[model samples]
Target: MNFPVQQAQGPDRIGQQTAVEQSRAVAEVQAAIYVARQFPRDVGRSRSAMQAACGSMALADKAFYEFPRAGGKVTGSTIHLAKTLAQTWGNIQYGVSEMRRDDEYRQSEMQAWAWDVEANTRHVLTFVVPHAKFVKGKVEALLDLRDIYENNANNGARRLREAIFAVIPDFFIDEAEELCRETLNKGDGKPIEQRVEGAIKVFQQLGINADRLEQKLGRTRDQWSGADIAQLLITHKSLQRREIAVEEAFPQARITGAEITSKNGGGRKQGPPDDDPWAGQPTK
Candidate 1:
C-alpha cells in the first residue's frame, strides 16, 4: 500500500519506461487503491479519499505510463486484496474518463465565447498581417484588450452583450442571444490567486482529492495555470449539468433551488410577490 518514490514537490515523470517500469506502474495503481480503501470513513473529507486514489493513480501514470511502456505481464493481482485493488482502479478509471468527457464538453461549449473575448485583438491587427515588427505591440495590445475583457466579464456583460447583439449576423442572432445571456460574465470567477484557492477547495465538493490533484501537478494552489483553472471550472460545470439532468429525468430526485434555500435559511427569504425585482420585468 506504500506510495511510489516521489520528488519533494511531485512525482518525477520518467519519459520512457521499460517493461519493468510499466509493470510497476500497474502495481502502483493497485497499491493506491489498497491505501485509498482504508479511507472509506472520510465522510467530510471526500477530497482526501480522492487524493489517496487519484494521487496514487496519477503518480503511477506520471512515473511510468506517460510514454510507451515496455511489454510485460501485469504483475500479480490474483490475491484477494489485489483483486479488490484492480476492481477499485477500474471504477476510478471510469470516473476519470467521465471527468475528462465533462471537461471536453464544456471546452467545446465555450469555444465561441473564448473567440469573442479575444477577437478584438485580431480586429486591431487586421492590417498588420505578416509583420514581425508589430509583434511586441500586438502582444501588448492583446494583453490590454484581454484585461479589459476580464474586467467586463467580471463586472458585467453589458459591453460584451451589446457587442454580440450588434456584430453577430442576423441568421445567428437567436442562438447567439441565448449564449450571450448565459456566458461567462457577472462574477463567474475571481482573481487568479483567490480562484486557485477556491478551485482547490472545490475538489472535495466534486469528490476529487485536492491533495491528489496537487500531487499530480507537482505544485501548490497558486501554481495551477490558467488552463488548470479552466479545467476545474469546466469539470465543476459538467458535474452540475449531470446532476441537473438526473434530477429532471427522475421526478423523485427533483431538488428545487427554493426548497434548498428554504431548508438552509440563507437564500432569499420569501415575501409577497409585489416586492420581487422581476415582478416589474415585462414578460415580453
Candidate 2:
C-alpha cells in the first residue's frame, strides 16, 4: 500500500506568503488613495454633517469621557467621537491591529493608524498592552482569554483615538466636542429632576450609590444641575469603556463599624466588605 507524505512548510514558503500579504496590503492602500484623490471631500458638507451628528443627545452621550487626574477631572473626546468624525469627514483610513503577541512577556504589541488618503497625511502609534489588570492596588495577571483580549482592546482603543485625532484637524474636534457638551446639557427634553433620577439609576447598576455620587460632586443629590448631570454622564461613559476604574472616579473612605454606628445613630447599614473590588474609596 502507498501512503501519501505531507510536506512541511519551508522557510521559502513562509517568506513568499509574507511577500504576497505585503503586496496585497500595498495594493489596497494605493487603491484607497486613488479613490480619495478622485472624489475629495466637501469641507462645508462634511462640517455640517458632523455638527448634525454631534447635536444628537444619543451620540453626544458617548462622544466624550472624563476621569480624575492630578486633583481635577480631565475631559476629552472618546474613540466613538473620533470614529464618527472619520466617517463623516470622509477619505480617512483608520484602524488598530494586533501586530504580535509575546507569551513570555504576557503582552501584545498593537499598531494604530489613521490616514488622510486625500491629503496623504498619516498618523501612526505603536504600543504594547500588558495582559494584566490592577486589582486592590496590585497588578494581577490575566489568565482568561477574554480578560486578556478586553485588556488589550481597552488600551488599544485609547491609542486608536489618539491616532485618529492626530490625522484630524484639532479645530474640528474642538467644535464637535463643544456641540456634544451643549447637546448633553440640553438632554433628551427630560426635566432636570427626572434626568437626575434616571442618571442615579444608571450609576446604581454600576455599583455606585447616590451618596458616592453626591460626594464626588461635592453636593447633595437634589443640588445636581443639568451641567453636573452632563459631567456625570461623561464619567459614566469612561467607566463603561474601562478607561477609568470606579474607585478612581468615586473614592470613599473606610469607615469602621463604630464610626458607621455613630454616624448612623447606632444603626449601622451594611456596606461592601474590605476585600470587595469596588470598596475603599474617598471622593475629593
Which ten-residue region of model 1 has the weakest summed lDDT?
122-131
Residue 183 in model 1: shift from native, Å? 8.1
Q: All candidates' lDDT scores?
A: 0.35, 0.88
Candidate 1 overall Cα lDDT vs. reference? 0.35
Off by over 4 Å in 2: 1-20, 253-284
After TM-score superposition, the amount by which residue 265's alpha carbon in candidate 2 deviates from its true location, in angstroms, is 13
Listed in order, each prediction's TM-score against the native is 0.21, 0.79
Model 2, 1-284: lDDT tens digits are 99999999876676768889999999998899889988999989999999999999879999988776677778888889999999989999989989999989999999999999999999999998888987766999998999989888888889999999988888888999999999999899999999999999999999888888897888998898888999899889889877688889988866765656544375747577534877767657
Give the winner by lDDT. 2
Go through the candidates in order and give the C-alpha RMSD of each one to the true structure: 26.9, 7.2
Q: What is the Cα-based TM-score of model 1?
A: 0.21
Clashing pairs in 2: 251-281, 251-282, 251-283, 252-281, 252-282, 253-281
- Candidate 1 stretches with Cα past 4 Å from truth are 1-189, 215-219, 243-284
